[model samples]
Target: MQALQSRLQQLENATGSDIWNILKGSESDLIQDLSTLNTLKEDKEKKGREALKVLETKKKELKSLKKEIETLRNEYKLHVEEVEKGLKASGLEMSQVTKVFEKVLEDSLSEKKTKILQIISSMRDFKTIPELHSPLKSILELLKDPNQEKLRSMIQIDLEDIHRQSMEIFRQNLWSEFQKQGIPMKKLQETPNPDEFLQRVSRIFEFSSDLDLLLIGIPNNRIHVAFGMLSNICIDMIENEKERDADFEWILTSAHKWAKNLREVIEKATERTGSEFDEKFVEFIGNITKRFLKKNQKDPLIFTKLATLLRRFEDTCEFNLTDKDIFESLYEPEFISKWILLEIELFTLSFNQLLLDSSSFDPLPSIFIGSASSSTWASEITVQFEQWISRVEKDISSIRNPEVQTTFYECLYALMIDLCSKIHVEANRLYSEASWSNHVYLVMNTIWELRRIVKVFIFITNRERDRRGKKKDIELAGELKWPRENSFLKEN
Candidate 1:
């Protein structure tokens, strides 16, 4: 319409006065069209008002209907409760009903009874079911027949008698086995070679004793007897070996191998040997440990022996076992795994004792233990530390054991055990976390370098590599882990 009006104006502008007169003549008709649109607008407003009133009336009806429905629902609920009460008063018990029977078979009592019996029969380890007694009593009472009171009493009496008789027989069998096999371990040292003796004892434990079952089973006197035998034998074999005391390395290596093998064999046996025997071999392990400690506690070289014994074992553990027969080697067939931790306990005790004995360290010159220079406590202990390392180097230099040479960690361990003892004492006495942090670092610095000093005697680590490379980088390998600067102040 706008386009038409614009075209008419363009015609008046181009064609002159006649087109302008015609456009003026159509203005009244345009006014009449606008008036007709206004009349239609009033009519639409009147119809919309009427529709809104009708919608409001319908909403009121819906609300009234909703109220009536809620009233009906409440009445239905009350009726359901009344019906349920009547049914319950007529001797119904929904609580006793099993969900399966109620849902699937419509609460069949016979089906529930069969299911309940299945549940009761499935329970094992009868002593564990004491908590179920009340429920069982309730179920039985529901199904009780007063007429069978005498029959039930008779069955209970018979069961009690049978249980008593069974237990008596079991006890007798245990005692009989104990009598035949629970004697002290026979002399395992017929041969000077310890391996054969170890094997013989292992055989006695395996075939005659059911040791795996015994270890998992109850421990009685027989178990103690077995442990006593193993302990006695282990300590004796090591302590009394021909020329073994002379060669400390050989004794340590043998101890390492035997302890590892024993632990392995015993672990494998106990893992799957789930027999119901009466006694555990772990207690025997404890006995072996006790005897070992008692026999060797007084030896001057006890700590070194204990340390060396475990050091070889620890070194062997660090290397990965790539061979398929590794387990077989450690836990060899028939020989029970020897307990290593027992010797480890002795080692720890010896170490702690060594730590507490300040006298073992050279006497510090007159001042406090923290100050060694100017005749202070520090100077004398440092002197002792040097002397101790010098002795260790001499000792390690004399090693004839090929195995000791082969495993260098054992050599390193030898250095650490004594070095750690000095540090342990000084750190506990002279330096603590609250007191003199820098001085603690000062003490630690000297202690750390002891390793480098010892390395010259037995350049066991990276010696070949350094020789092959032929460079000054060998110094890098020997550098001690110096204390970080944050905590330390060196005396100028």
Candidate 2:
């Protein structure tokens, strides 16, 4: 019993040193106590049984303590791991910067704002926008310390407010500067020296690039500001040009220059932001063209010039298009229909003027003594019809769309038939019986020439359709429901 008591005293002393360091020593002492308890178990004395029971109780207690120490150790390990993870996430390490940050947190709001502005200004030179947030994140981490909880809340709120106000003021100043640096599309157009205008454009591009770099902290700020400024400049130019009734060529050239240059800028601005400007630009152009079209619907040259300009713009800007689409897919079939009808109206007007200028179809009674072949003799109307057919062919050849060509050809066929009917009626009324046969030959000759012209146009139109892989039949004379005389020429 004295030996057991001695061992117990030793175990207690060992345990008192340090629980972590004494666990193994305490276990060794417990093992010796177990050996002594086993040796004393056979004594069969009351003190022996009591000693055995006491040893058993002590063993239970020590086992329980071991479990508790193990649980505490595991908990400590987890706590250390969590602290390491938090430090890593905060982009900070155990360093003296924490003490410095503590002092910064104690500064006045104005002083803090100044410091933040200085940090931001310095960080603006960072290679990437995301990298600029590193220093700010470190500041945030220092602010998150639980020791400065109240101070953290107050300072964070103040910093946020300061940042918001500063960003707004900064953005406005940058915007004002950007506006001043930007040369409007109208001014660029009016600039007679192409080299000077190009230099100004280069300067604008450089400014846009610098603005993008300066506004790195605000995501997409540069994109919005630059796009807005360009939008306003283009809109202003459109309004000014419309008011002045400027030539379509001028409007188109100016629009093209802006679009080509701004496209590259928009691409660069949106590249890092993962935002799209294509739809926005397309919508912008749609609106501007809509306004221009509304104002110049009566202008005869708008159709051809607008078509050429939009095709070039679409190609240069990488705008999507299908076979049936044109003008960056902005204008639809309805617009093309209007253009076709306008062209037919103009053709009719010109044809009417031609008739007015040379009203007589018969040969004048001029005494020409030169002998001529009677078979080769042709009326002035036949010559006029041939010349008119050549002009019509030239105009139609300039049209690229096969469907539009087919539609125009059909309308023109109807027009020719109506005009021929009138010519037949007029000839019957004016010619005497003696000249009736000659007049008939001359009229038939004109009809024959018109028939040849119609065949040639059909062949050309069908060949175009075949080239486009369209199998739809276009019977210009027979299949089409021809409009009444002069009815198709009316405004829709």
Candidate 3:
């Protein structure tokens, strides 16, 4: 707007000048009016000729003043032209900038005011504006101070500082304000939220697309700052949204999609410097593992979820496939492999407790005499297994190597054996026919259920072995101790 006003004023000053038109015919007008003096008597025409002479002098002064103003106007026009070109080169849309500036600086505007307003016009769409130091500085430097440098100095802006402030504002405030129409307040950070989360999340990616289109050629130092700012904001927002009652793994899985959007923006903005940006998120992953580990010191099912969480990072973060596995996995392959190894250990530990619990090994006919309410021990164990294994199967999609998959299956096989052995011991201890049939039915049912689950471990491990061309000399079910029909006390 300021630019248009400046331009309109410039066009008016250039074309609406009657002084230039008068100057172009001044000599003829002066000659025609003074010609009567040549025909008159010398004494009588002298005063008229002197009056004409004085009028001609004033006209010459006006002409000189007009020329000087024209020169300044021409200089200002050249400056505006150059700035518009710079805007185009910088990938900023001049048409949009013009419209935006026209609306913003409509009242207080000048040709010199157009440049920064053009850069800042992007504010309507996003909080963060592209780096404006170069274009703004260049344009300001080109401008001639209208108030003898007083007003110019007062209005002098540090575009870098403004850029920083805009980004910080975004970081400090939650994005929910912009997304009020999106995720319902009741559903925020809750389950059945992926769909809503995705709607808001897609905007970040779309925001990324806009950043990629920026004509901003900020310095490498500025690029680093951008990446750092964005990375920190991502970590902070995702962390701040931690919902205590919601599923931990589910929140992280959803959070990772947003993080990936930030990552893509940083990668695009930083280019060669993206490694530093990419590595920063590794710290977030490491922190999640540490937090989960501290919380799971006594919880049995957490390791499976923890392992799953780490595996999610490994898949999305681009950890290498050939590297040796570790107890810590992340964007860093070494650490990621290490994390995976730790998860496998935790997985093994959890199952060992699940399957080898001595309480399940009690073998007595008295176990059948208790009311249905009194003997919920086996049902409780089965319920826990059902809740756990379903989650385990669903969340470990990040496991890349076939060997790692086999290790987990082997652990499951071992667990199946431990559980089956305990049930077998209990089944052999029943005395009377009614008690034996009743308790034995329960024990055999437990064994068969475990066997069916072991079959999955069998199918996975055997298939993996085939893919690797390993000798299929061993059977998964045989190793897991499939219940052979050796009658315990001849079913008596």
Candidate 4:
């Protein structure tokens, strides 16, 4: 009994449980467990015997498969021998025939490869698409053979090269033809009739249309050269108008009309070729527009012209030319920084002119006293303020990016506040002189008029924004923050 209890304690320790309690329960339970273990041992031995039988059957089938494979190998050897005998009877060996056939195919492809390379090299010398027709057709014929798929792939690179060179040559020729016609000569100047200008422009269309028929079945052969040239001409004319001092309204209208004519000419060309006119023309115009903008970036008048140009394009043309498009083209960090600073220089000139004009004001009429009506000096400054707002709005209304527009508004607000601060400083200087009391009063009235104008400007702009269904986010900043606080300006 002591030995069995010691064994049961060992079992309890090994199992991590008090099995001795269950073991101490009944002898019938122990007898049933022993029966279940015996049954499981028998079942495992039976499964092992069945697995051995399945292994024996698999070994027999594998041995039979080896015999069948040997028979097949013998038959394959006999078939090869018969084929070799047949080749010998025809005065040909398998190895020799294969080498000869491979040589012929290789030589043929090499000759065609040389021809393609020659054609691509001489692409610039070729005058028309017809010059490319016979050689390209012959090379393409070999590409149609199913047996020559490898050969086709060998020349696919050359074919793409040809397409690129050909299109480049086409673009160059189109540009040359535009230059030849003197297309941009006086197109910038106002004319009673533009039909005569477009008539000369129609010559390039004829040239492109003649080649369009020949380029059928050729991939990536759409004629965009004319569109590109037209875009260049339009931009050049725009620059010309600016230099010629043409009317601003005319410049804006002419930009839209230029786009309209561009669309019409492109549509006419695509109709001949049965291809879709993509945004390539817009992109081309954008490139030229960037160059134009950069050239005139130092001139403040370009800003007003560019703004009005964008407005006219959006309002008139279905073509999507957004402010983002124009902004991105001119958005190089250094260029935009210089452009913004240029505005400061322009304002300084205009401000100096205003001061000069005010200096010349007769002392008799410039006299001021405390009254309900605004002083003459205040009236003149407010009128100038209204004009500045109008000019700024020309650019502001054209700015579509909300964040950029807000930044520009802040810039304008800062300029106004700076002007007020300067006036205040001058008033302080006047107050130092006891006889200049009326001058100080006039300057104070000017500040009050500026404040009134700011209020009216905010009200009108908010009403416009509300009508347009945009958020009324325009506001003022300073100690007397009327609409919103500008933390950036406050920091400055």
Q: Give lDDT per model, in order.
A: 0.43, 0.54, 0.48, 0.57
Candidate 2, 1-492: lDDT as tens digits? 555565556557565556455455556666877888887776657787899999999999999999999999999999977877888789866454576676665664435445545565665445432343455554544444444445444455545543454444444544554344353333433435545545544443343443333322444444455456666665666667734346544655565566545555444433343324444555556666766676677877576656666656556555433332334322357566677677677757755664553234444344221235432333455455556566656555555555666666677677666665555454454354576666555555544444555566667766766886754464433321222334322223
Instruction: Supply every candidate's count of residue pairs whose N, Cα or C atoms clash at under 3 angstroms.
Output: 14, 0, 16, 0
* Pairs with steric clashes in candidate 4: none
Estimated TM-score per prediction? 0.25, 0.43, 0.36, 0.52
N/CA/C clash count, model 3: 16
Candidate 4 local lDDT, residue 58: 97
Q: Where in model 3 is the C-alpha error above 4 Å?
A: 1-300, 306-390, 395-397, 401-407, 431-434, 468-476, 479-492
Q: Per-residue lDDT for 1-492 in model 4, tens only?
A: 344455566575554345655456545656666678788989999999999999999999999999999999999999989988999999889899789988997888777667656655665466565575555555555455444556546666766666565556566754664455443232323333445544544544543343343232453333456556655665666566655434534544555555454455444434443323335535554576576676666566776676666566556655554333544454556555665676666766766566545332123355442354644444566666667777776676665555566556667767776665545445555667776657655655555556666776677666756765654564552312211122213333
Q: Ranking under TM-score, best-scoring first?
A: 4, 2, 3, 1
For TM-score, candidate 1 versus 4, the one ahead is 4
Least well predicted 10-residue stretch by lDDT in candidate 3 = 177-186
lDDT for model 1, on a 0 to 1 scale? 0.43
Error of 2 at 375 (Å): 14
The candidate maximizing TM-score is: 4
Task: Say which candidate scores most in lDDT.
Answer: 4
